[model samples]
Target: MAEAQKPDLGPDPSLLILDDDESFLRRLAKAMEKRGFAVDIAGSVADGKARVTTNPPAYAVIDLRLEDGNGLDVVEQLREARPDARIVVLTGYGAIATAVAAVKAGATDYLSKPADAGDVTNALLAMTEDMPPPPENPMSADRVRWEHIQRVYELCDRNVSETARRLNMHRRTLQRILAKRSPR
Candidate 1:
């Protein structure tokens, strides 16, 4: 009998993760690396753009907000550099407007924050035309409210008074909510 041939297993693909949250970025990078990807990490849009310019990865996970600039800019750059790259955009403050923007900028998919490595992996490797199932349990109203408030607060430079004025809420009330942990 003829000897059986072994299947070919090619080298792992490269992955880039861009996020301002250092802890989350490191954790995700380590997880992806363990799952057979050569991972690169950037904490800001500038760094991410630089990385893409130097060497575009086969896959990317980008946070919507960055310290230096919006992640969409990086997404556009990646699209230009490598049109076939699979890119996923992540955001803590998920909004319809931003989701539309991400798609327009060439993201393969958009995922809200708190997504695990498996969810990201599935998104990057998905081949079917069918859409993924909607989240079984979406964020509660209170959680959404809190998230919006927090986003505005951050945009206001973490100034309680400015955030209060922007939201038309009392400064003390804003301070109280900020002090407490986010609601579920």
Candidate 2:
């Protein structure tokens, strides 16, 4: 005799995605939904905070920089509101200082920008005690330097002269490097 079909389990718990980049947020939300999470997307800190206050998700992916404010604020609120929620902070301007701050602020994990859906998912689901192995092929020295320079450039509010002065490099040189695409 044929066995009876099992009942379908509903989608997993809610997952909040906060990012200022419209395209990236939309894509990631769809991907997370496909992976069984019920996703809520927020493009700013205010929106994220309101959502969390209304109904905090079980998991969250928050961008370090938001249009209205820093993502750390959201992280702190989420921690206060939902201590059990797993929070992963994503940043294009990755730095040791900020990473420490994020973790201290209650982030379960921190990932640099360009993190794909799979990476975000893994980070969110990883057990607190289980640390994943480092990447086999880390970024090359040149790529690292480029990323650093770009990060500083952004922090300087995209002012080429200011970024150059902050980095102690010539403006022309900084411009040249910025003109080139990031090295593989």
lDDT of each: 0.87, 0.88
Query: Alpha carbon lDDT of residue 87, candidate 2?
Result: 96
Mark the 10 consecutive residues where model 1 has the least summed lDDT.
1-10
lDDT of 2 at 133: 49
What does candidate 1 score on TM? Answer: 0.77
How many steric clashes between backbone atoms does each model show? 0, 0
Error in Å for residue 27 of model 1: 0.5
Best by TM-score: 2
With a 3 Å backbone cut-off (N, CA, C), the pairs that clash in candidate 1 are: none
TM agreement with the true structure for every prediction:
0.77, 0.84
- The CA lDDT at 141 in model 1 is 88
Q: Name the TM-score of candidate 2.
A: 0.84
Q: In candidate 1, how many Å is residue 17 off?
A: 0.6
Expressed as tens digits, the lDDT of each residue in 92-147 for candidate 1 is: 98778899999999999999887888778777777548676555566888998999
